[model samples]
Target: MLMAKTAIITGSSCIGRESAIALSKAGWNVVLTARRADALKETSLLCESLENCLVLPGDVTDEEFVKRLFNETVVKFGRVDLLFNNAGVNAPAIPLEELSLEAFQNVISVNLVGPFLCAREAVKIFKNQTPVGGRIINNGSLSAHTPRPMSTPYTASKHAITGLSKCLNLDGRAFDITCTQIDIGNAATSLTARMEKGVLQPDGRRMPESTFDVTHVGSAVVHIASLPPDVVVPQFTIMTAKAPFAGRG
Candidate 1:
């Protein structure tokens, strides 16, 4: 019997939770990970098949923890076919000069370093496994293209993720490993609730921006994940139609 495909998703809430559920509905074994055990369990419980969903709560930033995450996934699921490198954090919306060093570093650790560590491990497994390849989908942001006011840390990290995705695509060609960066904007999630009220705009004005359903993001990811290994989408941007991203300045 052919074993079901498996995907390891980081970030147990919002996008990660919905993506895991979507993949499960599509018959993919899922391994959910995050810092909070309770939240991970909540996500696992919502999956279409509880039997196929494994909750592995831990920090993605820790190198050892990331290695263990992949190891345990392989041990439990038999193999990892895809990795959703989605764990991330954002610092307070403060002026760049006023942002604390600790805050900036923390964003980089979670948003950038965490994905790097996980991708490194996934590539190792993908290259050595029988199939000799897999896929990685990084959760980038509209900030990767244009920055919002008081978003130095988040924007910088997202911009770096774009570069990382390109490098992975170039290097993974030899092994059939494909990398995709999904640049999302104004997806309606807990993190974006503030947009409903009003957020700082480029001209120092606070304005409420439109947001799209987060489930769309989950579906988009599933579509990308379900594609043939030979076909790759290097970058995809999805956002609300009315989102100011077209002229984000």
Candidate 2:
């Protein structure tokens, strides 16, 4: 009998939730992780089958939690084929001088440190597994390249993510493990809800921004995850055509 491919999705919010459902429908056993049990359950229900979904709710910032997440996934599913390191958080919009250390640390812990822990565990599994290869898809933001007004913490963490993705791509090459990142901009999620109303612009203007459905992100992830082992797409950027990103003031 052929074993099913398995994928673990972190964050279980907006894009993560939609991607989990998309991958599950494409015949992947999915493990959903997030801090909210309720949200995880909601995501699980949308999957192709309850048996194929494992909902483990916990803070990604917790080392023990991240370890257990991988252990439980392996125990339930023989191997992990893909990891969508999608969990991330943003700091409050404030001047760098006004941004509290606590808030900045929280964003770093969740957005940067959390992915590092998860990637470490995933790499170990990929190296030891019989086939000895897997795929990692990181959900990066356009903030990695462009900075908005009063978003130092988020932009910094995302910039770090670009470096991480590049490192993983280079390091994992020998093991047949591929790392890819998708830079998203203004996806239609709660995180970007304020965009429709009006958000701070780089030029100190408050203007509304365009956003596309979160499912676009899900579709992009599914495509990346579906690639053959011999193929690797280092980085991809997806965004609304009209989003104020290319030539921001």
Candidate 3:
């Protein structure tokens, strides 16, 4: 029998949950992680089978916790084929000058450092695994390209993720490991629910924005993950049709 591929999704958010279900249904064993045990349990329950799904609740920002998460994944699945770097947090809406240092640090710790640590561990396993490779998909939110009215910390962290993805892609070439980034915009998750209620815009106006289903992200993830080891999708952007993603100030 062919050994099933395995994937780890961070954040345990709606996108992570949907991607877990998508990958599980596609015959890939999945390990889901996040800070919330309840949320991870909920997501794991949505998978194809509890047997194929492993819920490892932990904080991605904690170095020790991230290490343990990857260790357990490899022990359970034998190898990791994909890592969905989706855990992220946004600091409060405040002008750069007014943004608290603590808030900015927290955002960076979760959105930037967390992915870095996870990718590092995943790359280590990818290099040493019998199959000799894996894919990493980072969730670089829309703010990665353009900033909202008062989203300095969040935007900065996401933009940094772009650089991190590029570096990993270049370095992993010889090892057959691949890195991809998906810049998402207004996916209809609880996080984006405020968009429907009118959100602050760059033009200093509160405008109701459009949102697409988060499952679209999950589908994109599966498509990217399904590629052969030699193939790499370096970057992809998915957003709502009407999202203010084109030439916004």
Give per-model TM-scores.
0.98, 0.97, 0.98
Alpha-carbon shift of residue 104 in model 3 (angstroms): 0.4
lDDT tens string, model 3, 97-122?
A: 98889999999999999999999999
Q: After superposition, which runs of candidate 3 have C-alpha atoms over 4 Å from their true positions?
A: none
Give the per-residue lDDT of model 2 (tens digit) for 1-249.
878899999987799999998899889999999998999999999999999999999988889989999999999999999999999988778778988999999999899999999999999999999899999998888888988888888989999999999999899999999999889988899888888899887677899989998898888888999998889998999999997778743
Rank candidates by lDDT, best first: 1, 3, 2
Alpha carbon lDDT at 37, candidate 1: 96
Greater lDDT among 1 and 3 belongs to 1
Clashing pairs in 2: none
Per-candidate Cα lDDT values, in order, are 0.92, 0.90, 0.91
Superposition TM-score, candidate 2 onto the true structure: 0.97
